[model samples]
Target: MKSLRLIFCALWTAAFVSGCGAYSFTGKSTLSSDVKTFTIRDITLSAPSSYATISQEMTEKLKEYYQRNTKLKLVPQNGDISIEGSIVDYRTDGVAASSGGDKAAMNRLTIVIEVVFTNKFNEEDNFEKDFSFYLDYPQNQTLQEAEKTLVPKILDQLVLNIFGDTVAKW
Candidate 1:
């Protein structure tokens, strides 16, 4: 009876696993099977107020995100999937009012990136869109001081959004 129960459990587990056909824990199923590689062109710094390193940082961060999350290999040029874009906007503005209502209590730094994603295997999935994110910091902190911590967080979210749009389709 124990042996029979073990066999039954094995059969049930197999059935459950098979039921998940095309569903992957990493969300790779959304990408066509032909998509085995990807490429990210240089992301230009088009925003006049944006610092120079931001463009390069964003490009590298995106590459790293895809490498970590997907099985696709990184290529130099055209691949199964391609991504290119530029920093369209970068600015800081007061988001919250101070107790006196005369000054800002918090400031928000926002970054907007224009992205063009192309899928060779699935032309319908190609898209050109803008993804943006922001971080709020105390008004007392200078942009430079807050940027050291805030920029990374903003970039992380932007990358995630881009990933969702281009690959995860979520």
Candidate 2:
């Protein structure tokens, strides 16, 4: 009986340790063992054609984000999961009025992205939707001056929303 109790305790400890490894602190992933790879196609810019590099930057940012957050392999094509999106809108609007005039004191830079996510393993989880975010800047700051700092912040929010929808399903 003493040896049996020792064996049972050892088995329980092994099972608990292995189970803890299956949990993720970030986004939840319902991916099966066979669904191991993903593909993110080139993101297009339908918003402002003048900023030619925006699309490429967004694409690279998202790819790098997924690589950092998930264990899925990045594939060129025919992956178990696929994400394709476009920057549909990029514009600035006045949000806060000036202290003593009709002029604006603060402006908001908004970016609208349209994403389509496909899960080959579970067709029920597929979706196509718009993910948009914004940043506020003082009226003194020109859009050009703000673009460098604001674009990344906006993209980060969009990435988080998409990640939640795909993995966490929230």
Instruction: List, residue by residue over 61-140, the lDDT tens digit for candidate 1.
Output: 99999999999999999889999999999999999999999999999999999999999988999989999999899988
Clashes of each: 0, 0
Candidate 2 error regions (>4 Å): 1-25
Residue-wise lDDT of candidate 2 within 49-97, one digit each (tens)? Answer: 3255788888898888888877889999988989999999999999999
TM-score of each: 0.90, 0.82
List per-prediction Cα lDDT, in the order shown. 0.93, 0.86
Measured by lDDT, the strongest candidate is 1
State the displacement of the C-alpha of residue 109, model 1, in Å, after optimal TM-score superposition. 0.5
